[model samples]
Target: MVRFVDVPRMRHWVEERGVETVIRGIAERIESDFRRWPEFDTQARVASHSPGGVVELMPVSDSRRYSFKFVNGHPGNPAAGLQTVTAFGVLADVASGYPVLWSEMTILTALRTAATSALIARTLARPDSQVMALIGTGSQAEFQALAFRALLGIDSVRIWDTDPRAMDTFERNMRPLGFSVHRASDGAEACDGADIVTTCTADKAYATVLTDDMVRPGMHVNAIGGDCPGKTELEAAILHRADVFVEYPEQTRIEGEIQQLPEDFPVTELWRVLRGEEPGRTSAEQITVFDSVGFAIEDYSALCYLDSDLGEGEAADVDLIAEPADPKDLFALVAAGANSTVRLG
Candidate 1:
């Protein structure tokens, strides 16, 4: 049976307990996957970009299971009373390619991105770093802040956005959990003198949110935007100046900040650092960049983690597909379930 978990159900599952556990699990899984980096299938995300927005497919699998997410980004959607992005994903059996579970991923995206940011910072950011700069306040802003506060020891953020209303929404959502949140006038102002600078802007164009002039030595950047083909945040100059780290080199090279660089441009994979095959940052003065175009492996890691820790298989499941008792009688189940004795007609 194909099971369905809607957005509300997913939100409860994630916000209540599932998200933190999945993030921690992914961090551990990533570490182990990196230790044996050659074992799994990895590739650049498949994208279909249109004038309306972009839809992307991220697929990844190990020997055990496979997963994929179908996600789209449309900034103008808010005007239509929908979100900027809406998503759903599937978890499937690797051996037979049969879908095992499906869930809404709008909230999951926010959680996983934040989780990834925090995970990368834990590895590359300075040990004593407790402050961060969050540019682009939107639906994702609060999640990023909470994830950092939970995963790292982040205590403060200089928040800035092109839209003050977004900042207001972010601030309001975060009121219950107290943090030293300060507002900044612009992206550069937010990034100034920060230990970790996170960029989560939603624009689909090439906009330079951070110039080389804004960067301080030893700062760790979690570049979350510039994920698609034409979108980018940091100026190309910043790439030249920073020592870059990425989730997967093959994917990052085509989809991440390195897309701006030459074919032979050098960058380090985060797994290598996690695996101790490469150094994170050699000195306090060295700039570190995490060109984060989200990866499918992270999502796969998340789903398996959720599946395992859902407490005695307690996640609600709904029959989203017709089940036939006889394998060849495809129409029987639909016909049987359709007959109703209480029809008003």
Candidate 2:
């Protein structure tokens, strides 16, 4: 039997452990895995795109375990009373080639994405940064806010969204949690006087949610949206002015904000900075951009973290693998069922 965490159980786990605690744990796991960047197999995610949105499979593995997440992003689904993104993932034992855990990843993805953003920001953002300008206050706003607070001591958030209801939802959800939420009239207003700027809009087109004029020196931009071939948020000028860091250069060139630039444009992979081989923030007045496209290894770390904290009582067991009583007698199980039916007849 394989351990399973369905949507309800996953929600329960987060509620019981507290969201910030879970995000902190996942962030630590992500940092640990990134520090050993050479130990895992990493690659760009396999994507199937349509006019609506895209579906992707992100896979990564170390010598001991393998993990993959099947996720979809459909911007129009919200109008149809569905989530814009949903996902499921599996962790397998490499030696046995059998799955050991299966989990719902929609919530976990949100958690890990926030964790990764905060983790990189902690390294790249200015040390005394406090206020964050959140450009898109959709599904990811609250998690981003919480992660930044947990990691960077940021409690004040200036938020803006094209949809008024989204901004309202974000304010309603965050204010009671001891957050100082300020609704901004536009993206520039949101970004004004903020130390860290996070853009997470969901449009699948070449929409410039953040313009060049909005960004300033001494700020870190966590661009978590615009994660596909043609989707982009920041102006190309922003990339030109800021020093960009990415999870994987190969994948970022295809699917991140850097896609707006030339193929030969320079970028630094984040793992190198984490390993201390390269510098993160050389000066307090320099602009930094984390061109996050949601890499596979982040998911692997999140899955491993969840698996480690799992308890038998809270999780269900699923009979996903068929094991024969004898290794050479694969047909015996089926034959036994047939014989029992014949006897009854």
Scored by lDDT, the top model is: 2
Can you tell me which runs of candidate 2 are displaced by over 4 Å? 336-345
Candidate 1 residue 192 C-alpha distance from true site, Å: 2.4
Task: Give lDDT tens digits, candidate 1, residues 1-345.
Answer: 655667766766666675456566656655565566667788778889889898999888778788899999997888899898877888889897778878788877776777778888888998878789998888888778877887886869889888889888877776657878888988778887799999888888887888888888989999998787777889898889899998887878777777888978889888888888899988888889999998887777667656665553445666765557887888886685775678876
lDDT of 2 at 242: 93
Error of 2 at 136 (Å): 0.8
lDDT score at residue 133, model 2, on the 0-100 scale: 98
Q: What is the lDDT for 282 in model 1? A: 84
lDDT of each: 0.80, 0.95
In terms of TM-score, how similar is model 1 to the real structure? 0.90
1-345 per-residue lDDT for model 2 (tens digits): 999999999999999999999999999999999999999988899999988889999999999999999999999999999999999999999998899999999999999999999999999999999999999999999999999999998999999999999999999999999999989999999999999999999998898999999999999999999899989999999999999999999999999999989999999989999999988999999999999999999999999999999876778999998889897888876885664445552
